[model samples]
Target: MHRTRRLVPAIAAMVAGAVLAAGTVSACQADQKPEPEQSAAAPVVPAAPTPTPLPSAAPGTAGPDAERSAWLGEQLREIVDAQHFDDVVNAKTGKRPPAMPNVDVAVIELDDTGRPVAAANTLLTQKHPHGVAVPVTRDLSAPGVRWTHWSNSVWAAKKSTEPLLADRGDAPLEFMTPYPASVFKLIVAFGVARLADRGGVRYDEVYDYRPRKATCPDGRKPGKHSVSWWLDAMLTYSSNTATCALLMMLHERDGVAPMNGALRSLGLPTLRVVNTDPADGGGWSFWGLTMTALDTSRLLLLFTEAPGTLWRTPKGDPVTVGVLKRSSRATLRKMLRDQGLNQALSTANWCGQDYPAQGIPHAVPKRWIDPATGVVHVEDRTYRGDVRKCADDAEVEFAHKTGLVPSAGADAGIVTALPGAKPRRYVISVFSNLGCTYVDFVGAYDGACRYTEKLATLGAAVDALMTKTAGRATATLVSGG
Candidate 1:
């Protein structure tokens, strides 16, 4: 979704007011009693006795999952090679297939030591993501076993990269943008998760935040709510206020440099830490956190992985803050199912419902369950463009976030294909603009959903690819261990 810096006072004011209203903060009551600042980094526990590596599952049934996993590495390339995935844009449609236009894919395979093993790339119409390349003679077999750094790489995405930024500390990956929460959220989430371990805070307890009233920059009442409230807000709602509050907490703990440091740890070589808060950081400036499709998948995987790395300060001191280890991982996943982020959906207000809050009846065949209340819904609202956006509805359930800006309209998120059958999940991120209007391109108002549907199509294709891969792996007969 296009993260427009523009503020809609009506929505902002409502949220600020709701924070102090107490009753509306039903999720959890904030501790009105303030406490002294807690500054100590959570004490790190010594690694538990590294149990002698558990004997690899006796290679018996189904060709070892490892072989299958390994085979997939090659198979993926084969799939890319085998397909007539015309790297050409559809002249009639101007649509780029296989990889998006001006996109880059950075795959980092880790070794047994949690260090980088293999870093390969399949660039689209370029040398590196942003015209920067540093070739290294990397070993695939000796990939870093410590997945921590690898996980962090994906979490940071294309923004701030340092360690792996330049080939020889020179030609670095130049990101002329800020880190998007899509990437930073995972980094920060990792930090929080590790902190939870030290503070003995439960994942469920994290949601126990109350949006206590505070001074907001726009001079709204109670200004804003507590940072804890923002945890859920950012994770579920992607609230800017929550992101800033969390950033404030991080800055207090590690200073401003840590944010940049985390970016460097990953090979972004470009992520920047804004010196000032967006509210106070001058009107409408960018923080530069945009990332690619692959990076997005990586964050999802790391947060889902057990024992992932969280963050390390620029001083090389590690502060256990990755929340991936907590019960909340599952908590957050369930929250996703409950439509946690669906709060905005209820409001029927993206780009102020510029176009198709709901979708064209025949256009969008999807489902929506109220995150606040488990209610199925259909969005049929339209704004800015007076034209009817959604004409009809199909039986399929589709719940996703939509983005629109000048010539760049996108929609990304999970789709529950075959709603009854496990909601056979798929992720889609589409971007396109054909005959797009300026307003549609600026704040991402291209209501056509042309690119959004592309994402939907890509997701469906990937799911099929993975499933087919799995089926072949499972079907292969094995005779010996």
Candidate 2:
């Protein structure tokens, strides 16, 4: 992956402005659970006066920044293969990789923000074994620049923290995607929240949201949901209905960036809704993208901040603690809180591939089941084929998302400690697409599993690879493009 991002200086500038969002959060304020803790992520790492520059920008067209980022990505690739983590599992059959693949597994380490931290050394992390992944033909346009991800700024998140924006570098890497509409959707949701803040409306008092529908005769007298709850459904739950509903609520509030309030307050250079589909695809996504692990990694880093960015007043001043009660970012983040946590996006029915009734041709191989009912709280069912059972025996806890289009497939998420992982924490994201027909269940799974499986194996490799690359540019990044 080769691309450039001017993160250091931008991140460095927001220090003094790092105020919390005001008192705009409506419900579940007290119920907010801390983000799942792994060895504290890179977010905790204070932004330096300037960020270190990335090496690569895009392939065949990098300047200094691009070269560095490319160098970094290449280095990590080498490390993944240094001990042959690539072969830790078969790229093709999902079988174990060759003994050679097992030879040089790369090291994955976490930055202060608990993000994957690796050495900026090496070309591609070399796999101890040969590259056996067969190339598949697929379509998708050439990589184009686009916003791939954005995070809502909340209260108490330090201003010195990184900016709430990131994107795939202009450089083209294999399978990198620009910011998808999901990023914008969330951004719009935040916009609506800001509008509410300005208008003095509260989420709990407006639209309501729930995973299970409320009972009502003819659905006439059922209890209602709040707008914030709907916003949560749009985000954490990725609910299509909630997303569309929330957009409608903010039609009068949003501006050029999608949702509402002054665009300058949110500080988002890119965060606009282009589609409102149940699948979160369509509209702006058609532009093209080239996303990378690093790009997504950056987004993960940004989301860990506080939620007060939505409390800003008309003057862009802080309205609450831990966030600026008066800024656009505060209002934006608080808007999400209006819906509170545990909405449809974060809470949904968990049906594994065995559900059988949906004929959905989907199977969940991973899940974070509820402790009370032992039911899956987060079911990862993107995998097609017979692999539906993958999650049944998993020792590690996994939170995953999978996507597929005719010639395209993708999966990304985090894999935390299972019973067997020595260190017990990993974050992985992968995407793949080809110019061919994905005829049935197998294709659907192919579209998704490849990304997930690669991420699963690769994330583990990152753990080991970075451990070996310390202070050494010659260290590996898992090899094989």
Candidate 3:
């Protein structure tokens, strides 16, 4: 079931007053912070007002549930206040805060049966000093793997059956960005999977990454690889070129309209798939291709829950609800489990890991083809180092996806708490558009690292809260005036 809560005007006013007062204090003390001043990039463009109506349950449930919701709302307000303080400090010091100055978080705790025990959406509505309001930004690059509209679109198009390929008739797919491997690979994988299901293309079928007639600004070609290899590279390593190749193949086969139609069918008409990837060179804003944390959490629930239960088609038709087929879900889950970038949510701290030695592979082998010479070059791409570990050894299995670009960092997934008698599983999605730029610092990117640490701490706190409150009749925390 879907529900939303709108802060009553008086509560909103009080919260805003407290946040702004804190913001003022931070602004005055900005001179104390250190910095290698970077020009302020454009602030996040605020998301359009959420269309989901306020919760109707609030009026009737005046005792425990109401108190719990109010407590959660207060916590959210405090978080927003902290963010505002960071923003003010960053504005004064001209240094990017290691912690995101602005962020949007959604946390949901689900029972064994997949019913939500508690859920919260905290969207920061403060404006930057430059006057731009931070939108509920979701330029969650790697995290996109979890709920890419295209994946659902492909499933809808094929209707859980074989995919039929329509003729492209000579339309050339232009490269939108210099880097399209990750997203392009997704496009291609879905297309190929569709074709494979229909007997048109085999997963092992090797496709030439020849940009022969395609409009490629960088004039890059894909290395010779099978469809399956491309899919693995895209999902595992997040290869941009691999994503591009897949997008081109999809354009050649069925075109973009089907994907858009699929999004609408899945009850997410606003989630757009305009370009292949960010590197597509389209003057498109990354936030334009975004989703709210609430929507994202719901999508994750659909993925983790039983099939044919939670979602419906746009026409109110009962479509098979699970986002992925059982086998496909297993494959996706395996990939997510094996994902090495655990810096965001499943950090060494939250889900304990061996630091630089165990987290991300030092160097991942990558191959790129030059379009001009038709030559393939193999190279090793080194990843960033692990920053910090959790203070306590927490044995939590988080099957998650992390997305990070210069402007944003996001981590979303299913959290399975294994330490207790009754293991708890829930979904947590955190998206941050902090003021910190991604510098090439291993653990020294203090601002970014701090932000991540805060996020992990928040996750841990929420997990603990849920664990303590589980099976309790009422929330234990008393509401303060």
Runs off by more than 4 Å, candidate 2: 1-72, 78-110, 113-201, 208-224, 255-272, 275-285, 288-296, 305-431, 434-452, 463-481
> Residue 47: error of model 1 in Å?
46
The top-ranked prediction according to lDDT is 3
Q: Candidate 3: RMSD over Cα atoms?
A: 15.6
Model 3: runs farther than 4 Å from truth?
A: 1-101, 115-117, 127-204, 212-221, 277-288, 305-308, 318-320, 349-394, 419-422, 435-443, 446-452, 471-481
Off by over 4 Å in 1: 1-100, 104-122, 126-164, 168-183, 200-228, 255-296, 305-323, 338-451, 474-481
Model 1 agreement with the true structure over 48-154: per-residue lDDT tens digits: 12112212213232112343233333433332232212222322232332221232223333222222212223322212222222232211111121011111222
Determine which window of 10 residues in candidate 3 has minimal summed lDDT.
9-18
lDDT of each: 0.30, 0.29, 0.38
Worst 10 residues of 2 by lDDT: 9-18
Whole-structure CA lDDT of model 1: 0.30
What is the Å distance of residue 90 in model 1 from its true position?
Answer: 15
**Clash numbers, per candidate:** 61, 141, 26
Residue 461 CA error for candidate 2 (Å)? 2.9
- For residues 1-481, write the lDDT of model 2, one tens digit per residue: 1112213211101111112222121221111111111111111111112224332223322011323333444545443343222222222222321121111111222332233333121112122133221111111011232222211121112122222234435523212122232333444544554555566456566653222221110111222577656655555434545544554444434432334223334332232343322211221232222233323322222333322221223344532222213343443333333321111111112233321111111123223334344444422322122332333433333343333222223333343444443333333433332101111112222332222122233333443333233333221222111
